[model samples]
Target chain A: MHDGILTIDLDAIVANWRQLAARVAPSVCAAVVKANAYGLGMVPVSQALWRAGCANFFVATTDEGLLLREALPQARIVVLGGVRPGREQGFVEAGLWPSLFSLDAIERWLVATAASGTSAPCVINLNSGMTRLGMSPQELQRFIESADAERLDVKIFMSHLACADEPGHPLNQQQLTQYSQLVPAVKARWPEVVLSFANSSGIFLGQEFHFDLARPGAAMYGVNPTPALPNPMRPVVSLRLPVIQYRTITEPSWVGYSATVQVQAGQRLAVVLGGYADGLLRRLSNRGEGELAGHRVPIIGRVSMDATIFDVSAIPEAQLPPIGEAWVDMLSPVLDVNLVAEHMNTIGYEVLTNLGSRYHRNYVGGAS
Target chain B: MHDGILTIDLDAIVANWRQLAARVAPSVCAAVVKANAYGLGMVPVSQALWRAGCANFFVATTDEGLLLREALPQARIVVLGGVRPGREQGFVEAGLWPSLFSLDAIERWLVATAASGTSAPCVINLNSGMTRLGMSPQELQRFIESADAERLDVKIFMSHLACADEPGHPLNQQQLTQYSQLVPAVKARWPEVVLSFANSSGIFLGQEFHFDLARPGAAMYGVNPTPALPNPMRPVVSLRLPVIQYRTITEPSWVGYSATVQVQAGQRLAVVLGGYADGLLRRLSNRGEGELAGHRVPIIGRVSMDATIFDVSAIPEAQLPPIGEAWVDMLSPVLDVNLVAEHMNTIGYEVLTNLGSRYHRNYVGGAS
Candidate 1:
């Protein structure tokens, strides 16, 4: 607690939301606060977006929805994963809608609702093209006549896009065609329902996938939902750990676990707190670089579980801060989570979400 | 809590420790409990080793040492990162021994001890070949003559190997020669101190690198410290999540965000609770496979923030579990953390340690 720190930028997050919302036309833009808002701390993100006039929210599970419902209180919350068996009571009790994908789920919902005498919103997740979740066109037809849909509690019908991140991928267009065909069928069956699609990436696919409502997840957390865009989203989370010690390593000395690095001559080493356990991927051991005093310091030696050794000697003009100096104070600083993700062969989403809980979290920007 | 789960096998861990310990002879074995025992839950691992007669433990930070000391009470705990500039007093006050790497560190420790009117146990960490930390041959000589060394209580002297994991890397022999030379010098300077050198990889590098103590970290957590071994160590952790929904997709139907995948004709999709936020790297979305009812179900579509889609059509012979049924119950009956690690382009260590706390962690295996 005395050393490790994670500083999150909420203002950047709000700006990202506004930017994403601006990209979609006419359709209502909802923030996907699932996976703890891609691991940037969900409560703060949702509240910030809510103040920014964002209305709807989505989470992965009923549990996730429950948490958001408790926090936002006034926002419309949807559970991306349809309600599970025996979990419908909690969902209805909490007023959280489930993304119903299967006929069995629809039947279970009817039975639960009939038994509990509680009615809640439902979204039919239709399988447009990607073979992961959602109902087929035939299943959707069957679901319309199913006991659950006949009772008429459905509010939204939706499907997911699989390749929106790759703008040129052919699957996107094929999925769009399939999804468009299903829309009319769904509407004919349930004339009073709204349509929802378009995750963070889909929101960038223009207004076609936007439908009545658009749900954007990663974009809210500052991931460039549209990878092909000239300018992607700005980073919202800044990982900052303190420098535990700075030592001068002369030639022929090893650093870290296997002592896997060599200092050619007179070089300085800055040992920083937060290792793989703090979500600093071990893959970054020899391949990673961080900014120290605005200069890039290549990580030297094997990344230990709780600390990493950086070669600060090359940054001649950079001044190494005293021990326990925050990452922001380091002379050569590596503050971007996206770069850390790049070094680890992952996206910024993993870096932000897997961030361990040991760090002292401080949320900045936006309304507190 | 009903869905996300991780089961850790302590017996697998202890068995791994013994296997690695057997590889070394005439040398005392020490466990690296750093980074929460490589993210396998520290207290559980350390206690298992203590019962197995392991007496030495190594950690990276003073705070880690303090925590281990409370559970260990009597084990010889060593701080591997040495002492930070201003925190030596706390280490001494807590009766912790630090591995001293630099002249500045030794001097600082002397000053701190002198100011506190108490002597601290400090181990000298020499830079034999890895140039990340430790003293140069010249600095080592100067420290031997310095009054700081004479005044402070030096516990052990050691160096680290850089390429022990590679087994045949030339740096190992070079480090051996350099460390052999420094050993005599260090002994002459401080005759009554213990010595350490071999790490998890070094312990398998014959008896040359093994000094009085050998520190093993990854091996203690069930990773094959020697990746080339014909018979590797058993893995200790297995990750499982519930199947939130099972949906049918007809031809040309897409699933998941961005529409990255499409169903050909008939496909059964299972939406899982675990996603990137649960440390399931997104890259595994279309490339990875999870076991379901003895069938290998290829993950379809893009990995969502909190859900993933897997094609379960291949296992038509097997009946799918209803929604909310444990994914573990639906699996072909087994899962491997190492396999998931491979899909993530990392070692099992990263996957284990980076496991988010959102999981309901269940520690299995009886106490040794």
Candidate 2:
């Protein structure tokens, strides 16, 4: 097979989840399985996490929630993106909980629930300081004063962190303060409502941020929750690319598309079958590095749609394998996802999610 | 329903192919269906192209070739990445043509053919300029001198352009000269061997660059074949993202993750359900622009994994639709793929291929 191999260590993922779960002990550690579990196959990841005692799962859309519900019959699946106007009945029918971000969303949910004659559980998202989602303070106040809001069966009151990755960012403290004030008002209305505030990065922002539940997404996939410090999570993914061919230029030659890299005489190059289409960003052109026989090789020239060339001159001739039968490590323990993200001028989350479906995915150490 | 809508116009694709084909009349116009037809669903694209009189198809790897073979049993499918050492038999058995790039690949193909007791048709890739693949001049000479190379059945001799996008780049002329010299030498060995050159952009470099076969990939997908001139091809894709909610912040607030953008009071923000995980690059944060009810809005702060907030203060309140039932055009006729690529400092090719699978894909105008 010429396609690259994407080996996902489910044990490492489980270990990362366990590590984060241990860090925020006594608090509910919900798994965020949105974006197909960050593009690593949601069903498999969710199944593995469910087997590891994770009862609560968060997904981006109602469709994802339905899929997760199908996989985990008894788990509490929350739709983070909430329900689209006419799609509320679908969410209700699937027994999925929608995180009502606005007063309008709450009203729509109430209508769906009243029509079904079933008081479906829901979550209220309060906009602390992040203006992206959730009900604004004024909206929250108006909803809190309304009888309709009180009539619905609210399960969890949650808010997303805006600057959780940077613990020292002033917005973190500001958001925490806003969240603290908002939760009390929410508790006054629904005294038994569970509070969930912390995300992957927020879990590391101290115990105050970690309320009743912690929704960690990237951290479980081995992305560093605390970017300023060492990662407490174990690496989960390793990508190995198939070497198409190896060539030694006897004269000065330009390599790859656009002739961006000029190679000297006797410079050896190995063209690998992995490129931007495979989630290897074009920004990684000439900047990315790969490993061959334990030796580092710098990628030369622009990354093509389906292939990239790496300068493998540094590796000893004895260490190099036969041209068409060799595989090089593009992403591994040595060159982790985070480092590759840095090379591409993005975060590990983008790198992970952008991983194409072309890879031959292999799952290791998951529940049978 | 919160997922973005990616509408692909296959008729526009057919139109583009017709335009390119008309430009190089009598030269067999082959379609490059590599990278899942540049991440626009290969099966549908190939079927449409095949019906449009496209007899030849090119793919990146053997796996892609196998898929195309399953779809088009009678079409000439060429594997550009060539056959891996022990995998040559599979390619032969599947009746797929492998572009042999090196002398070693030729040797392995001979061995595989000997073991299978059947001669498989193959193409010879000559390293005219782009050194990423194919045999070097020295290697090509050695192969031509070998008796084993004469035993194998070769169909076409091809080389890739290095700088076809740049009309004035010296490398274009240099590669053309090299390809011209190499093709004649190969023809002397095999008089019936057809010559294939010119990619999408190379097709616009005039008839001289267009050999017996012209392979166009990006042009058929609505990418500009001639970057220096107006795009002769019609747009093929349009992406529309759902607006999850609209918020009017009355207090100072941060818009998205890391608190990248600080918003003033009375600022209107609309959170759209599309982010980097949805193939929108993070580099587009605070730079990308989306259209809401015909008004362009700047994306605020950092784009989260599942959401992005757009500054909709410029848009009139009366023009805006209901919060939960509205959608903004992320990529449309107003905001094309090329412009979006500019915001991320990349090309339209990356933007098209990076499009995530979560979107509800709708194919319009093809074979009907």
Per-candidate Cα lDDT values, in order, are 0.74, 0.88
- lDDT score of residue A272 within candidate 1: 79
Name the lDDT of candidate 2: 0.88
TM-score of each: 0.88, 0.98
lDDT tens per residue, model 1, B152-205 = 677788887767788987778987887788777678767887888888778878
- C-alpha positional error of residue B169 in candidate 1 after TM-score superposition, expressed in Å: 2.3
For every candidate, what share of the true interface contacts is present? 0.76, 0.89
| lDDT tens readout by residue for model 2, A1-368 | 44699999888888888898998999879999999999898999989988999899999987788888889999999999988888888887888999988877888888889899999589988888777788877788888888887677889999988878887888888888888888778888889899999999999989998999999999999888888898788899999998888887788988888887799988889899989999999999989999988888999999988998999999877789876557889889989888888898888999899998899999999773
Second chain of candidate 2: TM-score? 0.97
Off by over 4 Å in 2: none
TM-score: model 2 vs. ground truth: 0.98
Model 1 Cα lDDT, one tens digit per residue, A209-308: 7888888877776666755554477767666666656666434455665555656557777777777888777777888877776667788877766777
> Which predicted model would earn the best lDDT?
2
